[model samples]
Target: MTGTRDRLAAQLEQWANRAHAARIAAPRRRPMPAGFLRGVSYAMTNRVDSSYASPRSFETLRALAKRDVNSISIMPFAFSRTASDPEIGFIHRNPSGETDEGTVLAVVHARQVGMSAMLKPQIWLGGGAFVGEIAMDREEDWKEWFADYRRFIVHNAVVAEAGQAELFCVGTELSKTEIRDGQWRSVIAAVRLATGAPLLYASNWAAGAVRVPFWDALDAIGVDFYDPLSANPLASDAELVLGARRAYAPLARLASTHRKPVVFTEAGYPPVRGAWLTPHEEPMDRPLDPEHAGRAIAAVFAALEREPGWKGVYWWKVFSDGQPAAPGSRDHNILGRAAERVVASAYARIARAVAGAPAR
Candidate 1:
């Protein structure tokens, strides 16, 4: 796995070098339409890693395109231990997982299907703990971790640049490490050496999003917006929509303060009972509730559609293999469900109205 990862990384680096050199001589491309990004996150795990290159994933991309989705965020994973782990733990570009080659191909296919791509690289905890709790104790630990992290980001940076992805997230939700302003500034600087793509960091909403001090360094403010809008899972759409607008108002204000567009890099509710009560928390074992999921999704789009400060939103996730959500399944996947229709309708409404406006 490590050898394969190294080979892919090397290929990506060369691809990036060629791409950058060409960019230096080539004329600027025409501006894209001002369409708001109606996107869905595709989780590429080890079991489905090879699917990215398969015809099935391409078909799935086409299906999303038919739904009027204009963008897809291809999330690839790496790992670390506590925030102190000196090494990047096991860099999971495993052949069975999200390898760099597969990610690049996925990006290519997304564009082929007429959807833009955002390459979002995320770091998971080695012990399956909450990533929000990640932290380092000593100065030495910070130095070591940042060095390892730089290599990880650079690898993805090259992949995003070479793949010609529209956006690249420098990192995701690393609240503790993000507080290290000087260190993170260095990381962003190093990343720019590889990719000229617009860069952003996905900060967890509320807990970490408002606290990030490095927003000025990034091209836009990215938030994994999972703020709970209602205490009742069975809340009326009107109530949920109202609550959503209230919750998002502060985020819009923050974006205004920074003069940067805000993108909800990740956002979704589980198809489970009571999900609206604690929207950001991973779903627990419970009976399925696709109605609630549909309502929550519609509410989110409705609220954000009125907020001009927001740029785009990518729903939490949908597998590219087109897995059907079984009747009692409570996972995040919204395929073949009413929520999918809600998404399609929402995207169509905005695309028709603005021609190319982002979420506004």
Candidate 2:
């Protein structure tokens, strides 16, 4: 067992080294405008067994807000009950071990606990559920499928109406489905009618370019920037920063041409080695390395600061509590790992920069 573990470590070290060497040849850095900073905590739902929200989630968000986070994004998908069952008000188990029904009730609980701000809630759709092989083969069958999907979205709209969410995402990471015959516009129209809040759609990094067709129908460009960092394990902050810039240059250019504010719907660095992977795979377990996570997060903040037109960023997670999906797995993330603290501190710096200044 020891030998196997050592071999895995050696392979990872080699991968990290190659990643670092490539970063050395990356381009020069650019400084971000000092006062243009925004912070947000991306609240997790229950898709992953280990993920959950707690009173502390709100507390941490409140603390982070003290550093000038003007908004909060919540997921109303898996956390809330099914749309067919109106009586099932809040389906989520709160930190206190109580299940609440209705999305409005959940938000009310959050508010009572002092999570005040412009609440931005996201409703996920457009993945395998929306465009699986079965549905693709029966193109004529979309009308009924869309009708049901629209109904589910309407439930989210009801929650938005009750919570008064400042922003709402109509869908997430549904690239293949989004490109289908005007489906994006139809979904947007239905959601817009259901709720008057500003609308945005989130696409994975691989699907961002092809999903441009739907961008015109929405209010902002939301993307999850979680591309695997291919670099040396020992790469310095400067190298990471340069490497991040090269990776995101295309996104900056896209925002410029589209004239839309870019929102990083989800982004974070795991505190353990080899935890990062492509979107198709599940997150892996590794020991938390606070220093490495902190450095990587700092590098991302530096990169975003240098680039323009980035409206805000939401870390991939905040808090969780529950049994691990698998025994002895660290993938069930909760609490502030090294990366979370690094992000918090960067947020503090941005808040300080804008403190007492006039709002833009």
Candidate 3:
């Protein structure tokens, strides 16, 4: 046992030294501009082991490439029932743990497709409505939560560093705990020790993101923007675009104040009858309307095109299994839907426009 431990430690040290040497010898590449992250979020589930290695995974990658995006955010989740739980755990991954490994593989696959990768680790609160509700009343509970979260993040950070992922999200949508900026700053620092990749904290939305005082500690202002666009079930593209603009107004001011570019970590709308009325809701029983879904997506891109302060967007999701969406399914997954073409066109247009523009 002692011999095996020593051998493993030696291998890790050797790998780290090689990575450092390579980084030192490599020329500094020019930074991609603010609008560089033409991206999509790849969905991961607890049941799929070795998702990146699956045949379907590559198919999904091909589909994303058809969209002409230059980047992809690989989101893997770890769950905790509540803020008071003593530890954060991985509900996904067979045998209980492989987030770091899966993330590394996902990065490799994205790179193979000539797309930059973002390692986005998220928290899934079992049976909980949202992570925004996560909180603790006692100091001891806070300490316990941080202890577990730190270990989980640090583990993933090391993998991200080794995989050379272009970006790393320290945490996702933890609005309740995000106010503890000092502690989060420490968490960011710890992750930084293991990786040189640029980091961001993905807050729930601009409202929550603006309240996070520690944006100064990270690379970019990250928000999962799902602001209620329109309450009308059959809102037109112009109205939806206007609503998007309204949501972007305050976020633009916030980004200017901080002098940092803003990235939509996750932005999505379900293909449903009243999706425009409540952009964030996932009503399984709602009637499907691919046309409405496509319009909503186009509206988002139109607003982003007009908003210079925004940097990039990762559409909420494409599945890991690459399974075709059932005809008329009203779910949020965009795979194999008419919305996919809308996304592909938008991403292609943005990539071209950004490529031609001067860096900010």
Candidate 4:
């Protein structure tokens, strides 16, 4: 598995370098639509590592709505300690396997979409690991996994269709196996048949160029923004944003070439006070003051707004522990400090821009 992962990483580097060289030779930029600047964070699920059961994850949705924010992304991927575990078990099994996972996830997603519809919010659902891992060498195994993945997509599409979801991501971060596997096209077709909603695939920063070849087949480009930044203690907001834009340049070009909107499906800064926390390294360890963090987030929104062809950005999280500088600790929650307030302000700006514009 490690070897496969390393090989995939190498491939991604090659693609990124080529893309970057092309950009340097002839930089291209696209115009962003008014009202396209928006905020999205995971509000309906506990951290994947959390052992505690979430009580009414939709309540987080309610809280966000109260703040006059309406866009949200739901994660419905089944998670287990190992590969042998059932994907849907987490939602279904109580302490004693009392309820069904399908029923629970359905209710949660339904409520979120229903509420969002009332607010006129854009609703997106991530298919999670439902597609399973892409095996590099085992072609037959991939075929079988794709079969199961189709069923999973169908099931989720049924829910999204019923809930009237605005967008649904077909897959997320399955980098190693995406290139060799041709089943993503089938997955897209199945999802369209089921939901008829806009489809996207969320690729991680490391796997951006190599995975998911059918970029032209989807409605938009989805990327998870968690590139490795240096462990220095005081990385300025301007520096971070510039670094991120440079890293994301290739994806920006891809979006322009295809005339597709690009959404940062998951992007966040951890407010931890350590050099290396978790498997990823923190760019800066200073605890972000609520006021300072809010300003930093606003600056990022401004930069993204200035960038052309960019649709919007979704913060990594919204309500994890609700603590300041707590992102890298035992809690992997992406929303740290008073970042939500800044998020609300950014959304309001977008809403205003849309409202002021003449109707198309």
Deviation of model 3 at 329, angstroms? 2.6
TM-score of each: 0.87, 0.69, 0.86, 0.67
What's the candidate order when arranged by decreasing TM-score? 1, 3, 2, 4
lDDT of each: 0.79, 0.55, 0.77, 0.53
lDDT string, candidate 3, 1-360, tens digits: 999999999999999999878743221222433446888888764445427655567667876776797788887667887655657886434522345666787788888888888888877777865877788888888888888889888778777777888888898878889778788988998887878788878888777777888988888888898887888877888899998888888789878888888889888888887566666677777787767777888888888775666778888777776665777667678777867878888877777766757654
TM-score, candidate 1, is 0.87
Predicted candidate 4 versus true structure: per-residue lDDT over 151-254, tens digit per residue: 76666665666655556777766675467445788777767766655667778662365356888777778776655333344556666456556666787778
For residue 355, give model 4's deviation from the true position in Å.
2.0
Candidate 1 lowest-lDDT run of ten: 24-33
* Residue range with the least summed lDDT across 10 consecutive positions in model 4: 116-125
- For candidate 2, lDDT tens digit of each residue in 1-360? 999999999999999999878733211222222334254444544443333235434454455555455455566543222222212122344633222233444355445544432234333323423311223335554565556556666667656656655566776665555666487688777677666666677777623654467777766677777765445666777877776676677677768778777777767665555333332234454454446656766777887774666777766555423121233334423244665566667767876776887432
What's model 2's lDDT at 80?
A: 21
TM-score, predicted candidate 3 vs. hidden true structure: 0.86
Error of 1 at 22 (Å): 18
RMSD of each: 6.2, 19.2, 5.0, 14.3
Cα lDDT tens digits for candidate 1, 196-261: 778889888744687898888888888898888888766888999898887787677778888888
Sort all candidates by lDDT, best to worst: 1, 3, 2, 4
The better candidate by lDDT, 2 or 3, is: 3
Cα miss at 290, model 4 (Å)?
A: 6.9
